[model samples]
Target: MERMDGVPPEGEGLKGGTHRRTDGQVGQWRGVFSPGGGLQPLLPPPGPPQPLPYFVRRSRLHNLPVYPRLRKSNRRLTELRHVEGDIWALERELRAFLGGRGGKEPEVQVNEVTGSLRFKGRWEGELREWLLQRGF
Candidate 1:
């Protein structure tokens, strides 16, 4: 019998065709297999998984008083009231912290005039914990 390519179906004259390894291993191949019939060492095992920054010790929020209040209306929002310093700066820091924690950064609407920040989510618990850690 012949295949569409006109080659014998018995794999005659074929070179380097797929065949079982002499090692009797099954399934897909992994790592480098040398011509010496010995499996070379695989790449060094990956390093330990990294922990999120949130899990680490919390640093104090110096000179920045954060009072997070949860306000629920048509939407859930975390309101940072009585902020003694720049609200925009707080927003930037919060964004960086949340992003570092390996989660999507939540949207923050800053009311410069009111000196308050509206974070779009029910992050009351997280905010409270973050603030408490900062010695709020």
Candidate 2:
């Protein structure tokens, strides 16, 4: 690279590479010059992952339904992982409350595309209790 004598022309750096313009445009070489005139790499070093917000962390700890990504990946229609106690015990409870099945059976109609469930009739017994507890 040629040594520059004075202020370089726009987009022209001392290293013969182009710098990004203040108007948000990049020049031909796709490199920026440092204060000492060496080319500075475009990307910065990677850092650690950021912590979840306080509410999100609290929700996860309390076994509450938080963001979809924080929940189990293969959750079924009647399967909720947030209840207290062992997972198997909770699964048994949910299965019993949902009337012995995973998918919406006779009473509830589920839209396959949107995953929305509609109860054709009134919900009763443990099902009603569970839904109410979960604020549904």
Candidate 3:
């Protein structure tokens, strides 16, 4: 590329690449810019996988829930990956708790159109209130 002075910009350096004739080893990399341009590492290298929460070592109830149960009344709880305890898991846990063994427990059907989770049957606002209190 021609410079404003009509000379190829930075030709005194690499012919078009960064390296020293003394050694083929990589020289100072150019444009080590970060997301907002700082002298920090251009990109963070892959880090070790994060360890699971110590809560996992506690009782089963302390572990994360399968997903955040959004009730018909509208509420937001901890992420689906971090929910535990409270009445959020009740609907799905009931059949197992009662040993219904009818080969089917209540299922929560997610509405594809409205993005809502509905129970196989209503709990007379019980489930909705419980989830709301816990921000589910």
User: What's the best-to-worst order under lDDT?
Assistant: 1, 2, 3
- Of 1 and 3, which scores higher on lDDT? 1
TM-score list, all predictions: 0.44, 0.22, 0.22
Evaluate model 2: give its TM-score: 0.22
lDDT of each: 0.53, 0.39, 0.36
Top lDDT model: 1
Give candidate 1 regions above 4 Å deviation: 1-74
- Which pairs, if any, clash in model 1? none
lDDT of 2 at 86: 39
Error of 3 at 14 (Å): 66
Clashes of 1: 0
Best by the TM-score measure: 1
Tens digit of lDDT per residue, candidate 1, span 27-107?
232233344544343342256533332221212322233344546566667776656455666678777876676779999
Q: Could you report the Cα RMSD, in angstroms, for every candidate shown?
A: 20.0, 18.6, 16.8
Model 2, position 6: C-alpha lDDT score: 23
Evaluate residue 71 in candidate 2 and report its C-alpha lDDT on the 0 to 100 scale. 29
- Which lDDT value does model 2 have at 51? 35
